[model samples]
Target: MKGFRFGSTQGAFYILPGHGGWEATYGNETLGEFSSPQQAADEVARGLTCPHLSEVDTSTLEIPEKLSDWEIVHV
Candidate 1:
C-alpha cells in the first residue's frame, strides 16, 4: 500500500500506489491498477511537472492494515 503522486501521461495528475498490484481507497472509491510500481510512478510523473514529485517526502504515509471494505473497480 505504498503511495506516490505524479501526473498522467496524457492529462491529469494523480496519487497512486507504488506497487504493481491491488490498490484500495477510502469511501468505496475505485482507484486504478498498474502493471508495476515504476509504471505507476511513471504515469504520475508524466502528467505533472511539479517539483514536489522530486522534493516531497513520501515516507510518512501510513499503509492500511487491510484492503478497503468499499467497492473497488479496476482502472
Candidate 2:
C-alpha cells in the first residue's frame, strides 16, 4: 500500500490533495499552507523526530485508496 501520509509519528495529521497549494493540515485543523508539499512535510519533520512523516512532495509515496472517494467524478 502506497500513499501520502502526513503528520508526526503520532499519527496521520493531514493530507495534501485535499488542501491543495501545499496546505498542511491535521484533521480539519489547518496547520499551515506551505508553498510546496515538501516544505510542509519538512516543517512536520522538524517538529517530529520521525523521518517517515517528514518526506513529502513529488517523492515516491502511496496514494491512499480512500482519497478516491473524494475525487471529483468527471461526467
Candidate 3:
C-alpha cells in the first residue's frame, strides 16, 4: 500500500500502514509500530543515522538524491 521510502549512503527503510498505526521496517524485521507516520519515520531516521542497518552497509543507488526527504504522512 501507501508508504514512505527514503535513504542515504547508509540504507533504506519503509514506514507503511500497519495493524492500527504505522510500522517501521528495515531489511526484514519490523522494528516497531507507532501511532503516527512521523513517529515511525522518525524511528527509521534514527536507525539511518547509525553506521549500518541490519549489519549491512548498503545503498546501491548512484543517482542524485531526492529533492526532499520528507513525505506527506497525512492528508
Q: Rate the local accuracy (lDDT) of all candidates.
A: 0.35, 0.46, 0.57
TM-scores for every predicted model: 0.28, 0.46, 0.58
lDDT of 1 by residue, 1-75 (tens): 444333223222333453547332222333445665454444333332234334332222232222231123334
Compared with the true structure, what per-residue lDDT tens digits does model 2 show for residues 11-73? 554536443465555555566667765666666444523344454432233323343322232
- Evaluate model 1: give its TM-score: 0.28
**What local lDDT does model 3 show for residue 44?**
55
Per TM-score, the best of the predicted structures is 3
Error of 1 at 62 (Å): 22
> RMSD to the native, candidate 2?
9.5
Cα TM-score of candidate 2 = 0.46
> How much does candidate 3 score in TM-score?
0.58
> What would the per-residue lDDT of candidate 3 be over residues 1-75, giving only the tens digit for each residue?
667765546555667788999876665667688998777655554443233354542223331233146453432
